[model samples]
Target: MATRISSSFRGLILLSFFAYLCLCAHEAEETTETQHHHQISHTIPVISLIPSNACTSSAKGSERKASLEVIHKYGPCFQSKNYDEKVPNHLEILLQDQARVNSIHSRLSKEYSDNNKSRDSQVATLPATSGLPIGTGNYIVTVGLGTPKNDLKLIFDTGSDLTWTQCEPCARSCYSQVDPIFDPSKSTSYSKISCNSSECSQLISATGKPTTLLLYLRLRIRYKYGDGSFTIGDFSKDRLTITTEDVLDNFLFGCGQDNEGLFKGAAGLLGLGRNQISIVKQAAQKYGQFFSYCLPSTSDSKGHLTFGNGGVSSTVKFTALQTLSQSQSFYGLDLIGLSVGGTQLSIPKSAFSQEPSSIPARLSKVCLAFAGNRNETSIGIIGNTQQRELEVVYDVAGERIGFGKGGCR
Candidate 1:
């Protein structure tokens, strides 16, 4: 009986020992898993927040703004040459502009003659110039491109649709630029648009190229300015960095290989037109299709280009955008009359038609002209003149332009 009781007690002790071992092993396994999970969590990379994207979310579909500094090309701060040297340069630019204007008028006339019957009777007359700055003396904005970001100062052109810059491996030609040429090879995000793409097809059609050629060749874009300046290059997609921190991905732009003309020190051109390919259109999703700018009187004073409602204020005077069948790219304004210091001018309403080839006296120097010296011609320009005096708002949603005076000095 004593041996049986001792054997039973030994069996119970053995059972307890085995159960304790199993429990310890299970605990060890769970601890190892927890440590492994912690290791993985530390190894993973965290995504950094994008300012523009953050703003978009925080606004809850409300208005968001992105501000850009306006660079005055020939302002006193940017003048590198003497006044005498600038005179000849200005005259040369004016001549080129005159030629360009004549070419546009001739082309329009030919088009009218060819398709006048087929076209609508209400076909709007093309403007002499699209109120864009003609010469190198204009405004520019700094933009960063590529993965790591290569900064390029580009001209802000309201009349143009394609934004472009000189690129590397210039097998064809590239002019001397103030900044280093952008190298696509260095950018991981840079990509060439396939010929099969719709964008490429549209580009080919716009360039008057046969659609059949697209199947055999890559897409290329060519832009010719009124000043006789031209750029032809590949259509590509890349990242555009604005304000040094705000990044916009999959941005379409031209990579110029064969570039010529009066770019001055600018690396490229930023198209702000009402085209599908324009910068404003591309960023409309985030910016609400609204933009405004305040041009400073002096180059030393900093001006700004604001996306969304940054420049809007209570004092702005709104005007309806004129409907024109000729082109939707140009921002057309109806000029019923002109007032000078609260005095209305006696100029005929017809004189303000067709972008006014020449502004009458009293209205002199008030309208902005593409070419010619400001003194030789009274051609007024609202680009730098009015922009310098007021805050100009391009409200695409409202289909109107707003001018707020006393915003800039």
Candidate 2:
């Protein structure tokens, strides 16, 4: 009995010692991680762009006009129209949302397909579209570029990576824009990249096309939209002014010499994709691979785009981001179960699977599968449907996305 008691005491002591060692190691690891995060935060700069005054100056007027137009064209229950039909005023605006969702789905599917295939295999061409619309949506931001600072109102797009605007010396092609076209020659900071440059190499890798020699030293890039709109221009770098006080120099963007299709009153696109050249990726040093936006439902209302960790709220419920091997530019989420009212739906987990080739069609119906309130205005489509209801948070650092109700409202 005495020997048995002594053995039990020894076992307890050994366990306690091991626990202490584990606790100490965990604490040390946490401390190191905290210090590394601190260092990163100090190094990267944060940029926040709000809905510009120009966008909100006549908010009521625009909202009323937009609402009236939507009701007249699509009525209470919006239905998809034929391509040949003249673009309705409100439908044109809403089409931006549709285009964005489609672009994201296409890119993600392509990325997934590429990853599953073996190396040295020819990549299949996926039908991808540029999300650019003829005019600006309610979520517009004023961006200043060049030496004297040419402020241009641009549509903020998370689905794309290349930021571009119509430029002067438009001998080739230029659309009638509300704002003045950007002239690279006027800006002392403007410089065209060469085909042999590393930046051009990266562009080639992304688009799978060689850089075209447009002018004497200008390297050209062709951007094709899913809607058949395409822009061909010089890929150059210049200073971009986000706010009155904050300016990002040598910002890489396309100087569109020849632009066509429906790019209405807006000047260009502000890309916030996951690529290295995207606004999010370029500012990763400051934002730490994270950004969030709250898209407003009304045309008159304003939405915000925040960089880094400032936008995440404590109330948001997060789900792990679905990581794909090929497409790092998209934020994919795994949706296990969906609920309607108090009862969970009987939908299969595989129904929401994003298997690249099967996702685009499955995603459109995933929302409908719940059979919730059919009268709900936001349904059928992915972008406007989900965004209008939930305050979607992209936690890039954590590799997760958080969805919460009433945050946007």
Candidate 3:
């Protein structure tokens, strides 16, 4: 009897040892895979915190308010500033708008002169189709008017409000940022809209300008340095090209002035917002109801952008966030919960202030109050000032949820 018992015990021990080995192997495999896909750029010094339920747990009425205070006292929002130096830099709203319009008009005027003044006959360049396939969520879309259409490299921006590109109009003497400008003459589909048209007047109204303003399109325009400094030229009825199985016809886009020459080479911007005829909305109006984006993990240092029905990826689970649609389309996630390590972050909805301003103005400059932390969440923008798409992806990448730059009420 004793000999039989010993044999059984040895067999059990061997089985347990094998199971343990298998578990360790599985864990190591997971770690290796994660390491292979990780992307790290400039190190973001972060404050380590133990999450708390007092802040993260859902509360009702007055109890919720008290829980938020406890969260602010202990949450990372208090210590986040110590780690991230890119605090939100708020700019006055009026000043920003003024800078945008001024930049556009000045550059457009120059491009007109340069193009029309060229005495020699020159063949316009044709646009080359970008061979990249649109990824599931994040992708870049280049738009232009003609053959060799000055291809504008545009990051489809959801977090930003104003969508413009660099232009030859302003290139007259400004710092050359990107590549050559988009020319309309070569495009067989290009058609210009009159300044007297109702559409022109409507565009002015949205920008806080008068109806008399002459609006033109350049290949690109950008909002930079806390101002609306854009480079634009004349508009055209161009059939925007896309790589999709569906028929895409009669797409409206602008031809940037190649004369001013200020662009750093980005083609132009494709605005995605709630406005009447912005890029994303226009596509959604014609295509499907859902539009998604995926930012390559900045940790990897490389990413792609996609648009239209063709741009959806299966890699990451998408958590649809709330969005504000006042001045433009802004993304948001329900402030249902926040966890810092093991601790939950407590924030009060009462502290949030929702106001109408440029999307960029809100995200990087607004100040909101946190419990123990006087001001929390200094949102900073990353990537090209021309890349509005990166902003949305950045916001989504971090533990920080919601969109817009502002202070708690």
Candidate 4:
């Protein structure tokens, strides 16, 4: 009987020790308990095991500036009529993420030697019925569209340029969404663009194709994403509300009449890319073409998407930004150095790169949020999983990208 009690007490002690380690890993800089491992060559960075901002919610920079909460699509905050929809497993998420990355490589080939002259064959062509961007990942942000301002959940994407949503009178077909399909007829400010407008000409640069004309000479667009998804719809302008006070009049967007893709029940997507049609460019005058975001670390936790430079953090480290020659929408950076824990890894600077998840107890079930490239020439993509807790700033007017650690909202 005494032996049984001793064994049970030992089990409890082991469990308590594990719990303590987890708490320290997330909440504190160092653990009171020591760890010894045979395989590791150097000490693991305990400080980086779990970000300090996990599950924390706060607002910083610009009370009047436009900042919105970003939530995981699979998290508790997302509202959907279809509760029966199956949540994707971690493997499914990895596959979807890989597909999105592959599409990016297809759209922008890695070989930079040839002067980008007839690169259409190497590209993922978007016919009217052909494309919708990416896997949409796990995070989504809600936005107000139209004059009366109907709230729409959109996956804000830095790789895309056109902001679009599923619209009413689904002339052909529309996907199921978390919010009501935006009815343009009900909005007083909705207006369609003409096929001959200069804005329509810009569509060629944005989507890799010319705008098609509808029956009334109204412009229509067809966009194809790298992940084998596509949207076909009317090109129109309306009042876009970032916050109650921050609104953009005559905001251009795609009213997806025939939309098909894995948007994960989002109404649509908001483009934060660098082209003239992107929200970042359209709001250049008011927001100074400056925007920053910090993706949250966990599925249930929340981060933020902030526009304009008001009340900006002083700690952000700036790096030069270079546009990819293959696609103007994609951004490239020079990855000259890498540091893990407190020590810098001795990697070569000329290994030359063009482009760059969750928690578990025992840490056994944890999956890597990063995907490996097929070849050295394959274009590497930096997904939200890597951007989690990173304060990423896009200084378009200043022509740089900045990063700071431990950033969350």
Candidate 5:
């Protein structure tokens, strides 16, 4: 019995020693962790992590990752019961600390994206369209051409072919509102067709008025900003200077003209529609064969226009209607098929008008008219009433139509 008691006492003593050793080991570990935290705090203060502005929702994820990355690379300055909840108090502070290197990287990223998008747009012309009238026929816009006499922009149009702006032969002083008339005297390449020139004759407005030229394209733009309108002062023979991804050359344009109430910047107009030998056509001949324009939508007030190659994106299907004979140029289309999203739509042949009066004199001129808005005497006035109901797109790459407009608001 005495021997057993002694053995039990010995066993108790050993167990106590073991427990004491474990306690010492745990204390040592705690001290080591504390020392590591202190070292990190000295290296990078927590105050350096906050941004000047409050973090936006987008930055939250990035901020979290960045904070963790810093900790991983250099150890953390603070301790948390749970590692997942560890976060810095500020993000801008971190950015400021790394400002010099960070800014350079950010700028390079932006530039790369811009360059990529421009190149893609230029190469996508097979599926895109020029916002300008590249072919022949008729097209119209509510243009406010600035008058050289009064500098008043005027707006009236027919989807025809020709470009001329109001110029200085007016009964009144022509320079009151317009910028100094385009002085062809300035450009080495300026050439004038006589007032009786055939090109000028073709410019006869549907209203039977004579077309006039004031300033032709050079390499300058004269702006009159009082009425949300402006003008390009440079007109040239089949050449235009525009900022683009491609090296554009030899385009033509009407430097400026006075139209009535069409734009918001100046007293001039750019003859961009599919009129004869206008600025847009000249540029296409010299650059890429196509361009595109996306008008402002209610959801997105600003859109884009691309010439040449366009971007690749998922396409909504569409039904192509038979293009009117006049649907050849300026603004024309060959209606072949139509689809919405992925569904095809059928259009009745009766939807087309066969009456000579209902049809435009020109075979390629497609008339956009309302069912009840047809004027017995009017030739090709596309009724504005129906513009809101349909989205029109033209496939000119095919055999039926060469020009197109619509699918924009």
Candidate 6:
């Protein structure tokens, strides 16, 4: 009896030893993954805390305000316009986004150096597809561009300072777009800015390229993006109608006669950068320099871009904007840390960097949306995934940015 009991006890002990080994091995695998994410960029993690019935969660205490319908290029709105979504190569997208980041850094650096030397200089995505979106895409909004109102769909960009579109009589070459190239001549409100005007000289700081006289009166300007795409055209102003109640006149914009870039069938860009040239600066008096936008977390849901503070909810959280550079053209946020599965990541604060930089990871497989910039000294962009399903509000007058959840509903 004693011998039998000893044999059973020894067998039980052996079993426990194996189980312990298995647990250690499993933990190592997990450590490897966590380390992978940690090592990739030394950043942290952000998990979606979206509650069920997100619409109720999103709208509780928040007013449903509308101004411009912000749509994904691959969403139903663009498809209804007969514009096909651009096929995305994820690796390529990352590379190009990095290029764009590089361009922005270069522009900001030059602007900063010029300021220290004499002051003032110049500067510088898609997620929709097959249920597989890029971290973000060129979000578009429609607005009227002249008398008789040529309603144009523009890629509303907070990173860019000049609102521009392809114009009629493509003086050089223009990319094909869904809307008819804006016929500036047909618009009674359209007027070309002269080379000698103060506004024309402002283009020097805006585009980071000096204005040149194509003729004694014509101010021809060229603006290049980090993706190696560019626009060379006339700098002009026209009446910009955002909504029936929110019309802005004398809105300076680019009439791209020689526009080259993959805009994915949108008419052009709407600049909302942090300078006097941005629409935010141009329309500050009417709207109080306040605007907010929500990118839908899913394709079926809707997102919006409104120009007032009427929709702010009580639950919204605000983060102070950090000046990562001298130009201050883009929205800056200090992403001090990240967390995973409710645990804060143990890493340096220097890791967090740009637009909504992540996607919800899948089960049993982790693919981080963060990428390392060219160098650690590079400026960071507000990560797109970081803003997923949240309302991003810009209070330029307040000099602080805010976010509210449940916005996609």
Instruction: Give the number of the best model, judged by TM-score.
Output: 4
**Candidate 4 structure, TM-score to reference:** 0.74
Model 5 lDDT per residue over 106-179, tens place: 32234345444433110001100111111111111122222111222222111212233434333232323323
lDDT of 6 by residue, 1-409 (tens): 0111110000000000000000000001112111211211122233332222222222322244436776555444455454455545547555545544554556656667765653322222110101012223346678999997999988776766677888987887887677888999999999998877788766655544433332347676566644455677778899999877668889998888886654747787777777678888888888888988776553334567778778676666776554444456656553433455545456543444544535454565454545555565454443454455666778888977776766555
TM-score per prediction, in order, is 0.66, 0.62, 0.43, 0.74, 0.34, 0.72
Q: Local distance difference test, per candidate?
A: 0.52, 0.49, 0.30, 0.60, 0.26, 0.57
For candidate 1, the TM-score is 0.66
lDDT of 2 by residue, 236-275 (tens): 8999876555567878888888878745555777777656
lDDT of 1 by residue, 84-155 (tens): 123225366455444434443443344345443433211112222212233443566778999889988787
Among all windows of ten consecutive residues in candidate 5, which has the lowest summed lDDT? 10-19
User: Candidate 4, overall lDDT?
Assistant: 0.60
Q: Which scores greater on lDDT, model 5 or model 6? A: 6
RMSD (CA, Å), each prediction:
28.8, 16.1, 22.8, 13.4, 33.0, 14.8
Worst 10 residues of 6 by lDDT: 10-19
Task: List, residue by residue over 1-409, the lDDT tens digit for candidate 4.
Answer: 0111110000000000000100000011222333221111222233433333234454552242689887766655565566334566556655555554454555455323223443433222332111323335456788899989999988777766778888988887787777889999999999988766776667655555423332237776666654356777888999999898899999999888887664747788788777788999999999999988766666556778899986566777776666655555555554432344434355442343334322334763444433446664455444444455767788888977777765674
Q: Model 3 Cα displacement at 342 (Å)? A: 7.8
lDDT of 5: 0.26
Give the lowest summed-lDDT range of ten residues in model 3: 10-19
Ranking by lDDT: 4, 6, 1, 2, 3, 5
Each candidate structure's count of clashing pairs: 4, 9, 69, 8, 86, 18
The numbered model that scores best in lDDT is: 4
Candidate 1: the clashing residue pairs are 367-380, 367-381, 368-380, 368-381
Runs in model 6 deviating more than 4 A are: 1-66, 80-85, 113-137, 205-215, 339-362, 365-369
